[model samples]
Target: MNNRTGAIESVAGNSNFAVNSALSFGYRWFDPERWGHWSFDLDFFGSYMGVGVSGFGMSDHENLGFLGMRGRVGYRVWHDRLEPFIGMIGGSVLANTASGGVDHGAVWGYWFSPTGGVRYYIPNTRWSISLDGFFRFIGGVNGLSGPGVTINEAPHAGLGGRWLYEPVGIVALGYRF
Candidate 1:
């Protein structure tokens, strides 16, 4: 499950929240006898970020969607039932702005996140639960311009040209095989 939620505070001093859901699949490999409690994982995910409502007080116009993959390294502790992990994610996104139900042109961009999480495995079952958090960085590279908002009457965007930062939290249920 890729359902996530988070808060956004804009330069205009407006704070709002966003929600997104996705489907994901992953593979984990661990060899406790040889590698202690270390593990490696790779996951692929796709999600729809929903309509863009500018936290900066601008009118909502864009619908954003993304598809991404993550790679993680983890260390297990406490009878091998608890694991803490760190990972990185990279993906492509599509943003489209519309007015009056008329479709506008779509712009493509790239996004990345530096993520970490903890997972707890059930004592007697191949099941687990996790809580993950990350800060996502987004930027438009093609045909999408203009600052998202302004602060002190000055334009404020992300790093490296035009960028946006979003913080997210996720709670997930999992199965291990």
Candidate 2:
């Protein structure tokens, strides 16, 4: 069983509450009936993330948004009943915040993610459930974090993770058309 727990992000001793989520639309690229056991898909995705910090009687809140596209390759091993897939996602994110009555405009950064998941179609319905996991690889703290270089970058090799894993994954219910 896979699980995920939400937590705050810590950077250079500064920590803030961060919430991450995504919404996507996808289309199968190849004719499933003709492909026989393998399928390809293209997806357009968007994500939302909120970060908040409070200390010294001052509070700063931020809303981060992301948009991207993904390409997926999947294989059906059990009569189209069970499928396992992997995909690549590329996108950009906007980080906007307000601090002590001052507003900072949105900052942008590019990112790439490699994801894997398993899907199971319910008995005889078009509805399916999937458990997906991915590790986002941010190029660098290019914008969003101010002019200063990012103190902590992606591919963290800390005790907790090298790449963001479970408890950080997404589960979705989808319909095949």
Candidate 3:
């Protein structure tokens, strides 16, 4: 339940938000029956983005992406009309980057992320809303160009900015069965 992580495209003229487009897919498994308001979860998420690049070899653009899986423990309060939950997620993170086109070669690494989020569930319905965020700590790598920022940053580098450890935010719609 969140926005995809990657470089944000900045396009000229109309279609302003198009520059910020990202493709993301995720799956989550949860226990519907809470054990004393606590639940267990298994989650998987992935994202990809490519944008036009300039001043980098003869490459047309840069591509970056990541895939991750995490286990979570959560606690819910007020299980009736409005349910609020808080959870912590931890897992392995894999990221890869292709800069200055595919010919420049791609660099990748394994990393891990610790995340927490709050979710609101509406009663009598299977739909829910969530806002989650996490920090990406690249394994032993430091410093990356925009494309390298994600996995090295693990899909947390959305813009052309420098960061030691990158942060990501996710606001997405979810369904519970």
For candidate 2, the 10 contiguous residues with the lowest summed lDDT are 1-10
TM-score-better candidate, 2 vs 3? 2
Ranking by lDDT: 1, 2, 3
Per-model root-mean-square deviation over C-alphas: 8.8, 8.3, 9.5
Model 3 weakest lDDT span, ten residues long: 12-21
Local distance difference test values of all predictions, in order? 0.72, 0.68, 0.51
How much lDDT does candidate 1 score?
A: 0.72
Stretches of model 3 off by over 4 angstroms after superposition: 1-34, 49-62, 80-104, 140-164
lDDT of 1 by residue, 9-30 (tens): 3332222776776667989989
Candidate 2 structure quality by residue, lDDT tens digits, 36-116: 888788989898877677665556676767789988899988877888999888787665766543455566656677889
TM-score of every candidate relative to the true structure: 0.73, 0.69, 0.55
lDDT per residue (tens digit) for residues 1-177 in model 3: 112455454332211111222233445444556455665666666655445544424334444455666666667677533333444443333333344344334555545577778777867788977777766554533334453333333334446533324566777677765
Off by over 4 Å in 2: 1-17, 29-33, 97-104, 140-168
Winning candidate number (TM-score): 1
Question: Taking the candidates one at a time, how many backbone clashes does each contain?
Answer: 0, 2, 7
